[model samples]
Target: MRPPVEVCVFLLSLLAPGVLYTLNNVPALQEPLPILGIGMVVLGSLLLLLLFIVRHKTTLDPLFYVFAEFSFTCLVGLTNALEQDGFISNFMGFYLKKGEPHLSTAYAVMMSYWEGVVHFVLFLTMIRRMFTRKSYRSLGLLWAGSSIAHQLVHVPGVVIGKYGSSLRPAFWRNVPFFLVPFWAAFLLFSRPRETPIVTADKIASEQKKSLLSRPVDLLLSLLLLGAAAFSAFRGFVVLDCPLDTCFTYIYQYEPYLKDPVGFPRVMMLAYLFYALPLLAVMLCGLNTPGCSWMLDWTLFFAGAMAQAQWCHIGASLHSRTPFTYRVPADKWWPVIGLNVLLAAAPALLALRCHARPAYFMKPVPKGEANHKKKKN
Candidate 1:
């Protein structure tokens, strides 16, 4: 066994800023067309570097390549966040101007921070797990959910929002960002779940308990319902519902939902149609016997909510947002507190399932259960 090839990937990600500085200085490279070409060259260089590392000392899991590439992209995303905040100059300005102008918006700025920071840390952690020969299945599921939710909102939002009219050739560079996560997700879900070992009696006793008996589950059920209701309310607020409550809530509670950038609007609707129903099913998972599915799905849902909430909250308060659209000072606590509650429910539910999963485990066969009892 030799040193892992992925160590190089980590190093390259750290070196990204210097590389961007060098690229930024090239006058010709400042143009969008040249910048796009530079992207291809950089990608090709990374692929060649990967191949070389593979030939030397690599486990060479296909996912290793996917994650390595994605981790590098995280560095780029971080650079975007830095540039958008004016902490860095010349690094991403050219690309920001023509490649993807939507990124200049407050929602996009916050999204860049989430991707650059949260998602970057996640990808790197998963890669480290792979290097250590540990089970990354759960983390992979988390990253997959986060990445897919990001693309589902981001790509479509850019294409259809106010920025749609200024579409440039460099915009297509997001193709991999849009497509690779779905592929990675399919691969991750296909892998066998690495379940924890537990005695049959433990599973039996846990599964035998009703929802009412578990105070935590009962409490979480109520919260999940509240989260679902909030999701629906925000969806209606974004859609410009006729209800006076919706109108007041939009203006006073979350005017960011009406931002021209479109990402916030799409995000609220996603909470409505996709995340809302899942909350109900998740409630069922808490009460139902033998719902092993909850373990994986809840982890996935938790990741999405975490990312979604981080971006939504940050963007809503970010200075880039028009002051009029920003969260009002008078109603800040109620609005932020409600959003925080909804965001926390999935995480609590996931932690509950994963921390002590016996209740959600499949029941052992009667014969097997008897044998285990006798053996014990």
Candidate 2:
């Protein structure tokens, strides 16, 4: 199979069931389908695990994969619980059917919040790894501090619930999700200016001579920038109706979404605002002799896109429809078209820029020569 086709199959195996649950109405498929869907997701995740093991011989960022897997599991578990309880009878119908209280709801909510926390930790780690030692240390402290504050809120919530208190802690326990971007903004704003590592003279005279040179590098950087911007914008803005009161109700009804509008908006703005500085660092590192900064950035970008899609699906559940927003048959064609383009663009761009091949190369100098010597 073609690489693109393989990737599509992999993604569809993970995403199709959730999408179907959200956009269809088939009773027999309601409960069993999510189980089957989650099975596929687990299969895909295992495949990722195998790939990581065989290739990296260590691990993909554990933080990224763990949070992603937990998110999928929670989603599937929630759907199954809701369906069995008859809260969701058919795809389009919702009615409260009381039964023995299930701890799955609380578990699912806690997992969801932790997923956000893990995401913040992952990004902060990525930024730290990409920058200087001093910057890394400073950001590490900030991440640790924010994490403590976030969990402090959760402690009261957990304790109060256990003590038979009717009052629940505020939903702002999830605010760390947005606070991450705010901290990133502070880092960006306070960062000192620096001169470009590659001089115009070098680019004009030497670096532009070959296909694998400065121009190609610049193009790849721009593509990465564009992909990141598109993903962030879609995540923060496009998926929701701007004027819908549902936005307010999401925070009011779902304790998780409280203070939704302002935080997300601020986070999104911070992401956009920091893009240039981050891109500059990426480009500088890419231009260095032995650095694989481009590949690192691409991985971060792809992970962010996946996280955004997950968030989009999760937030959609907060709507009045609550998982029965159907896409018309006619609309499917366009939606599929858009999804295809969105998924394809990043893969193609990565391939064209040789980013993936470079990623598979060992990070140490003379890595290939050393391997051959050991083999001999």
Candidate 3:
């Protein structure tokens, strides 16, 4: 049987860039735009492969994978949009010479809007699945706060930009709140499900008797805790650094300052935070059924990190006029080697987990009975 429409949409997004080259005017392959386009296509293909596996077998919660894909697609679309819109100039050199709008901007924006709709639907599903009425009500309040902040930061840009005014501050302000639904989804999924009373009692007794218990659960708990700590530190402390001293600070100069680092940082950080929890949950034995969720996140982070290195770090290192202070051009291999290793490790781990049966046996939720019927 084929996967759902949502899964197909995500797969198409990943493949769209390469397909676009064949279908529309192919952009130059040597530039970052083509590279990014190809990267998305590859990532989406990997995810679709995993989704196919889950659809054919296993009983894991389908919505989890759907929601995860939604988050990942949003992230990828946002990344592409930011780059196509010339936001990445602060961190990387453009392949095209000055004075041309990126051909891919419209495609990126359309994908981003669809991503937002999917993301909101995913949030609603999570709320229904994990939260009781009272808990969801509390979560709703938090969502409202984040939504307000997000709009305050982003809506003005949309409004003012229509009137020929710059609203950069609005975009910056919205960053922190943009992922509130994502974070809420993470917290909702992290809670332990209610097991049979007998099984619960047995596990409780085992826990009291032995320190070594539920290795996956232990690791998951630690990861979640660590991610939470890291996020808190980043928000309250790391961002405290003055605008002139941040890692991407060099880009704030007159010529390069046309692009701001705030939006990219916010987008990347939110994606990383959202992904970490899902990874933790899967690692903790949440039966993902397929590797699509894993693949989605792997690509999302890999793409973001690549952009950071190429644009953020690389750009800063060469920001000097006339591009001075270089070792041999041949030394570029070392950086490539490091990136390959970093991207490969998680993908290998995901493949290994996918090959095993222990992690793919989660039961489907009762609410998704119709979805199951449709699949059958």
Q: By TM-score, who's the top model here?
A: 1
- Candidate 2 worst ten-residue window by lDDT: 94-103
List model 2 lDDT by residue over 1-376, tens digit each. Answer: 2233223323433552365365344444334334345345555765575355335324333333323343343344344445544565342221111111222233323334434455334443543354222334333333333333323333333333332232222222234443544454354434552212332333334433443654665666566566465545434442353645545323333223222222223233333454334544654554553343344343443334334333332333433222333233344454345444444444444354342234223333355445644776
Predicted candidate 1 versus true structure: per-residue lDDT over 178-242, tens digit per residue: 89888988888888987766778789888888888999999999999999999998888888899
Candidate 1: list runs displaced more than 4 Å: 1-4, 57-59, 366-376
**Overall lDDT per candidate, in order of appearance:** 0.84, 0.39, 0.38
Off by over 4 Å in 2: 1-77, 80-167, 170-219, 228-267, 274-276, 283-289, 313-373
Give candidate 1's TM-score. Answer: 0.94
Kindly report which residue pairs in candidate 2 clash with one another: none
Backbone clashes in model 1: 0
Best-matching candidate per lDDT:
1
Return the candidate ranking by lDDT, descending. Answer: 1, 2, 3
Off by over 4 Å in 3: 1-238, 242-263, 271-273, 279-346, 359-376
Q: What TM-score does prediction 3 earn?
A: 0.30
